[model samples]
Target: MIKIFTTIFLLIIGSTGFAIADTDYQLHAELIAKNTYVFIGKKEDFSMVNGGNILNTAFIVTNEGVVLIDSGPSYQYALQAKAAINEITDKPVIKIFITHSHPDHFLGNQVFPDASIYALPTTIRELKTNAESFLDNVYRLADYWMAGTEVSINSILPLNSTSELIGEHSLRYLFLKGHTAADLAILDETTGVLFTGDLVFHNRAATTPHANIEAWLLSLDKLEQIRFNLLVPGHGEVTGNISPIKQTREYLTWLDVTIKRSVMDGLSMNEVINLPVPEQFQNLAVLKSEFMRSVIHRYPIYEKTLFEQIE
Candidate 1:
């Protein structure tokens, strides 16, 4: 009877892949620099297998306490992240900074109720206005992995650059945009680690759900001017070089030109999705899917702008 029950359980899990996504998030922290660790996420889109763990979340172990960069995807992810942090140090997380208003970056805010959560005024406003819908969308994609997760933001980060001396680290915040209406990039003056939110995607294709290509290019230019020893992007691995910024710029430039050309050529959205991808961007993770998404999200705006110009 026990053997039969075990077989039945295996069958259930095999038949439905989501049955295996039990509560364990399996988070591990990777130390990148002196007292700085990053929880690198999978380079894939949201699915039942990855459970929305497709973005980076990092924490800085300072003299005072832990300073968290982004909260991650869900309540379970935050719990597991906190547990992983505990394995390294017992200090409480004093501050949680949400880089942008993306669901993958800030949904884990609920688990850190004691910590003060901060984001740009635009981020806070975006969360307040669209968080529920974003939650609904993730819940659909990740299923049970999003259990008990809710939208939470406590404080608003200033819309301009600011500085804070926390413990042994001197932090400088850069307010920039292009990936979204507002993106926050943090430069740790003490360690030279720059955390550029989703403003830069290393080997992964950038999502244009809220992208402003023109503004995004300008933000990248600003980032290239900053001298940083290490860069922790919102997605992909941490790097010490400026290649990621260049890669992101190249892709966004291509995307802008492609979409504008498609509109001028009177190509349908489906046609644009089927357009040939350049060899350089072919190696990017989720290239085709992200390109399709970008077309669906941004093509209509280009179409409308071209129409207005013709009028």
Candidate 2:
């Protein structure tokens, strides 16, 4: 099975200009708060080396059972996460929350068959629409690690609810958008920890393939108002302050302004792609590549809007 998938992966990625490398799959859960742990992934893009483990997945242990934040990129990753969770506690995972439809965040849904996997209703709609394409892409990028991985969801979490008590933790669900059409931010009211999903990327460039910058900035504002002791971003390291929220806001704000300015300046896509990144964002992981991607994803829309204004 592994060999078959690998051969197919090589063929698909080769055609799509992807290259493979190597990286270990070992995962360790870092305890961020009392009874709360997070498995931080690399602050890099998906590669065979990282095997698509480029997003943070977390868990909280409560008296009833364990609550998992996101599954992960592949079955292997979920297995590693489960093993890591077991090392710390023997509690069974009773609930799983998928923050968004991003493949790296939810591909491992099959691994937790018993856990009640919940995604926002819109998130479920997105997974239903895009899971197959996402699966194909991950297989092409991660190959053997993606074996047996398939899109799976057991429940749709309504966006209307404000909070729910599971185990000893009171989880407040924030249904907001900007990162995608449906993004779920989970706040552990009991632990004062906020899992901001992909809405906030710390020390890493935010991806905008499905981004609505205006909406995203609004979501950031909402997150800023929420008081939390620690923030676990979908990517990057955990922080005790709202620095991540501020950083994401700054980046998105800059991206929106820059893109609009460039379009109005009549700059071509290539020019925008090669433009120098601001000094502040220079140190972000995958800064250049993600910026380039954002340009490619958003430039045309900006161009179209400007054209419409003149028309």
Local distance difference test, each candidate: 0.89, 0.88
Return the TM-score for each candidate structure. 0.92, 0.92
lDDT of 2 by residue, 113-216 (tens): 88888888888888889988988898888776676677775454545677999878899999899999989999999999999999999999999999888899
* Candidate 2 Cα RMSD (Å): 4.2
**Model 1 misplacement above 4 A:** 1-20, 154-161
User: In terms of TM-score, how similar is model 2 to the real structure?
Assistant: 0.92
Clashes of each: 0, 0
Top candidate on lDDT is 1
CA error at residue 54 for candidate 1, angstroms: 0.5
Worst lDDT window (10 residues) for model 2? 15-24
lDDT of 1 at 220: 99
